[model samples]
Target: MTMRSTMLLLAPAVLGVAAPALAQTAPTILPDATVLEVSAEGRTTRVPDVATIRAGVVTQGQTAAAALSENATRMTRVLAALKQAGVAQRDIRTASVALSPQYRYAENQPPAVTGYQASNSVSIRFRDVAKSGAILDALVAQGANQIDGPSLSLDQPDAALDEARANAVKIARARAELYAKAAGLSVARIVTISENGANDGSNPQPPIYAMARAMKASESTPIAAGETQVSVSVSVRFLLK
Candidate 1:
């Protein structure tokens, strides 16, 4: 083939590939869209449905075996009393069991082992909050010396969390719409949605300093279980046109 013929044939192939590249490099022209991002929280409160109680027995004796034996006997009564008070077997859990030696120290002498002390504790969960205080009295009658807690919680926390999540989305959408309207723009659609998290926001109550030894006050052990609050937050982005 002649030089002119070769040039003519190559020109078409080069132009065919260049055409696709030119189309790819072309800029797109579309309506300018704005975005509105917002974060919001939802909270709900309801009466607590469950209460947890920690109770135990502490015994002392000259020997470790004697101390442990006495503590075990008392702890048996405590467990029985819990059952008698209507606490289910599934709700009762052993927390701890330990035996430690008591020491007596002199000003310039090494410490001497005086005796041994044994402690046994168990945790109980009461579904019926109304009977908690009365049950506590029952445990005291059964020889429980160390008692702590009436820590309150909700039986079905998932229910509260679900409600909060729904409310969070609704509130976030309302906030985004308000901002868009104030800016003289209209919300086209929701572009994205993300859940931050849910938190109970309640601190655990510390054990009472002196209640460990006493079971009942002069009157019926009075207990007040307040409401349980659940909080949820969410983030949303809305396309504004």
Candidate 2:
């Protein structure tokens, strides 16, 4: 084939590939479109449905074996009381078990071993927050000496987060339209959407501090499941014309 024929044959193939490349690189936004990016946050509050608490027994004795034995006995009773109170076995998880020596410090002398302290703790989840206080009293009655926390939260947060996300988008669009109107322009369309983050803004209650002998026998500990806030932030790009 002549050189001129070879050149003609390759020209169409080169043009075909170049055409698509140009199309891919072409600007998506119209020349008259003005880009406006707005960030907005939306929040909603709901009552917490779950409560988590830590309950434990602490005992001291002259020997590690004695201390551990006493702690085990008390913890057994505590677990039984939780069962009697209708707490599910899956909700009762052992948090910790430890035995440590108690030391007596002396001036200019080696620290003397005084006694051994044994502790056993379990984390309990209460589906019914209203009954948690009464159950706590029962646990104490069964020899749970150390109690901490009734941290409240939502069991399922996906629906609440979705609601917040919708609100954020609404706010962003409203704000963008306001900006457009202020500039004597009308909103053309949304260019893009990006989510910044989501957070659970729960107003946590103060941890409950209870001892076996602190409260009166007739009064059950009171629990209040305060409302928790769910928030979502979004960035939206709108075109104005």
Candidate 3:
């Protein structure tokens, strides 16, 4: 074909491709709309039914083997005491074990290894919160040197969380209704629902200084457990009519 006729045939095909490209590159214009965001919080309180304590043995010796041996012996006694106190074997678990060199630092000098320290920790779950204090004291007498936490919790946290969730939904609906009335709009339907988080508000009780205190040869340690709280938060979007 002649060059002029070939060029004429190609022009329409090129224009067809360019038209779609231009349409795709075009910016879209959106209509004006208002967005409303709201947050709701809810809380539920319950007397804690269970308690967890973290206790351990720490031993230091001139050699790693000696330190570890001493720690193991003490931990054995602690475990035995826990079992005797009615703590189930399944509820008691070894959380951590470590043997590390202890260093003694001197002014303007490289530190020297002074001794070896061995630590073994066990986490104990007490189903009966009332007996938590006594359990702690018993463990201390049995040779637990390091006591970290008694983080109070619930055995069945799901129930409490559900109650809190229901309360949260109620709170959100109330707030949304109030806002809708103020804006002269009616509730249409729920657009979205989301959970921010849920938690058992069991604060870690202060570490008991039971290990440091000198106990009478025959005295039993006294312990106390306070109440625990559970909380939940949710975000819901309701379409306005």
User: Which of the numbered candidates is closest to the native, going by highest TM-score?
Assistant: 2
TM-score of each: 0.78, 0.81, 0.78
Tell me the lDDT of model 3 at 27: 26
Give residue 64's error in model 3 in angstroms: 1.4
Q: Quantify all predictions' global Cα lDDT against the true fold.
A: 0.70, 0.78, 0.69
Q: List the residue pairs that clash in candidate 1.
A: none
lDDT for position 87 in model 3: 92
Candidate 1 ranges beyond 4 A from true positions: 1-33, 200-203, 209-218
Itemize residue pairs with steric clashes in candidate 2. none
- Candidate 3 clashing pairs? 133-223
TM-score of 1: 0.78
Sum up the clashes in candidate 2. 0
Candidate with better lDDT, 1 vs 3: 1
Which number leads on lDDT? 2
Candidate 1 vs candidate 2: the TM-score winner is 2
lDDT of 1 by residue, 1-241 (tens): 0000000010111111111121133122223546566667778887887888788888999999999988888888888888777789999999998889999999999999999999988888889888888787777777787888878888778877777777776777777677777878777776555666676634247885223445436765666778767887666656677
Question: How well does model 3 score by local distance difference test?
Answer: 0.69
Which digits, one per residue and each the tens of the lDDT, describe model 3 over residues 1-241? Answer: 0000000010111111111121133222122222233456667777777777788898999999999998889899999999899899999988899999999999999999999999999888888877777777788788987776667777778887878877776777777776777777765555445677778667677775435346565645444565677777676655555
How far in Å is the alpha carbon of 11 misplaced in model 2?
42
